[model samples]
Target: MREHEAQARTPRRDARSAATGQARRGDVSGLHYTPDKARRSANLAAFVQKTRAVDSRGAADLQKLFAEGDFIERIGALVAPHGLRIDNVADAYTMWWITAWHAARGENDDPSPATLTAVRAQAAHAITATGEIARASDAQKQELAEALWVQSALIDVAMEQAKRDPSRLRAVGDAVRQGAKGMGLNLDTIDLTSKGFVPVGVGQNDAPATTPKPGSAAPYGALALAAGGIGVGGFLMLRQRRG
Candidate 1:
């Protein structure tokens, strides 16, 4: 999966609805904010934009950044001119997703564990390098945790869907919803690029979640890579957990 392709598959909020949509989630966008809050929000957006630009350019060096243990200083420095500061958990949370997708979309990788490792590494750095995670609201904290759980779940379901139809990623949101269904999570809409998510229910089936143990790093949106080493056998192995 190329970076642009991975991005193309990830759902982003419709730009026309960003303000109203993000505002409802109590995110950086609201009717008004303190001057400092507005500044920070702008900086965060700049950081996200700058980093994503690197991926868009088709540069391979992104894997180097993804391999680093701490993003607080590493990524922060890269996007500093663009105004990124590691002062808030929202920034930290957003960076994790960015790096995860970058890493997952890189070459010769398995998507599920790659996403998990990227997220875990970012959380580890956020915990050690800043007080923001500790200071984050309980709701924010839970959102971060659930997002992590959904990381592996997303890949597993996509892989399963790919078995029946390799182009399942073309409809990424729908595929992700099927993954959420197994966990009994009802989603109105789930967008990976968006900062917030709300699962509407546990599940219609009332089935217990059978999360896969994070095994090894991989790529996202690379159903084609399944043929590299994870072919039919690997997909079958995933059934127990993703079912």
Candidate 2:
């Protein structure tokens, strides 16, 4: 995709919570590539999702929708800090669900238009069925964590599929100092459209609604969807890339 839609409101956390989060930053091992390494301690905050109600059972059902794909490890690296507790089956299930949400591949290394639609549909369903799937302080954190997953996962897809490679992942990573630029915003403040950050999106001009673009939504539906959700003014642009 030429641009990944991304946008976020400023943080709503209190200074004390912010400070505590800062103190805990160094303990996060999820920043690496291991899924089981990001745990710190058992946190009890409930996920108050806005879309719908959910529970461990509902989350397990959602997991069945996930697709198997490559570079899921890359996606885990992005959201590891927020933490996932295997003791909490729903949280762990969601971690896997979100990971597969981004890493699944399709025919010729790209998904068909129908596949893209299905991806977007399932993401929407996830929002509905995952009110309590994650173990986070609140919905904002959930959004931040998931948004980061989208970022990392898209980079995985874009590495080989983006036709223009304008925001070359390698160069862009260097520009952000390996995501430090965005992370400096305290997760909530990381502006995807910030200086030097190119938002990724799906589709191309003159393309059919369901026509697949190389690395656009056809290949990176989760990425495209996340960009639109977090993107400026909450608009998902729907822009596409060339073949």
Candidate 3:
């Protein structure tokens, strides 16, 4: 992604309350990634690099998808901020989900077209199951989390297997579905189309801010201050001379 592209959306905060609140929600309903964002998420990039077939076609396709696909773009947005950091469990979960999502959806070695459809179906089911699990017992939540991670892992394995042989799409799909059962959450209602910053703090609102870029100088203020200082200094110098 171009630096200007990243610079375009000045790093404004949605009040600490909002950004952090989203962080705390532990839900993935409101996460969206635009085409531009996917290009910058290092974690996603790394995953692509490690698993994608090393060729111009694969490279170009991945790049293009990252820049244009809604799903890929959302993954990019999430990956960019944390860059593989598991600091927040929500972020970690989001990253893993997207990684799995992308791996399954891609035409790469992982999921054959038929299997890919099945994988999508499984994801839909997993998503639904996740919502149910949310209201279930603690044991259920733990079980759900594990199931989600496993399903996600199967996506990775499938992708790897595809890259290695390219004929195991069915196997990959089956593996992905089976693994998903181990993850405790579902993917259906966890909306991935809408994304915004969430903030949190005492009495703090989660409204996004409109501010100048960090490195951008407040030229007007600086000039005004300088002018005032210069005027004061000149007056002091003149008075001293007169004395």
Among these predictions, the greatest TM-score belongs to: 3
What is the C-alpha lDDT profile of model 2 across 1-243, one tens digit per residue?
323322222243465678777744522322212133222111111111111132343222222212222122333433343443323222332332332322321111233444433433333233324432222333323334433433433333333343345455434334223233222212112112212111134232211111111111112232332322223212112222212
Poorly placed runs, candidate 2 (over 4 Å): 1-136, 162-169, 175-179, 185-243
lDDT of 1: 0.35
Which residue runs does candidate 1 get wrong by more than 4 Å? 1-119, 127-130, 173-243
Model 3 misplaced regions, further than 4 Å: 1-96, 106-132, 174-243
Please write out the lDDT profile of model 1 over residues 1-243, one tens digit for every residue. Answer: 699876765545455377666544543321111224344333333333333443332112222322233322333443344333344333333333433332233211232434434343343443434444444544444333323322433344344455455344434435334434433333343222221211234323221222211211122223222322333334345543432
Error of 2 at 169 (Å): 4.7
Model 3 over residues 46-161: C-alpha lDDT tens digits?
A: 43343344343434433443344333323234334334222222333443455444443433322233433333333333433445433444333332332222223334433543
TM-scores, one per candidate? 0.26, 0.23, 0.28
TM-score of 1: 0.26
In order, candidate lDDTs are: 0.35, 0.29, 0.34
How good is model 3 by TM-score? 0.28
